[model samples]
Target: MMDAHKLDCEAAESDCRFIVQSEDEGEAIKLARTHMHEVHGREVGDDELREEYLQVV
Candidate 1:
């Protein structure tokens, strides 16, 4: 089976319940980073994103 990862924007206290899932942790981080920047106007760094958003599933 492929690796699974998840990220929930709500965890950051945003009104967005947007949850992103990916077969790779890197992909999940990229998606979450882009979403935060485009939708929430927050540009989060990779380390912070990994620590805060990226969740193994």
Candidate 2:
């Protein structure tokens, strides 16, 4: 099994209330990217999301 991960939109300095938690890193990144685009109006890459936003929880 994969470790659980968390991604917070606030970590990127936005006021978005979206937070993603999943055992699948790919799902977390995918959701985060969609949220960022739908809510924050930004396009973030996977590497950036993984390095800056994704956290093990």
Could you say which candidate leads in lDDT?
A: 2
Error of model 2, residue 41, in angstroms: 1.0
Model 1 CA deviation exceeding 4 Å by range: none
Instruction: Give the clashing pairs for model 1.
Output: none
- Compose the digit string of candidate 2's lDDT tens values, residues 30-52: 99999998887899999999998
TM-scores for candidates 1 onward, in order: 0.87, 0.88
lDDT of 1 by residue, 1-57 (tens): 876889988999568899999998888889998998999888899899888778888
Write out the backbone clash pairs for model 2.
none
> Best TM-score goes to which candidate?
2
lDDT of each: 0.87, 0.89
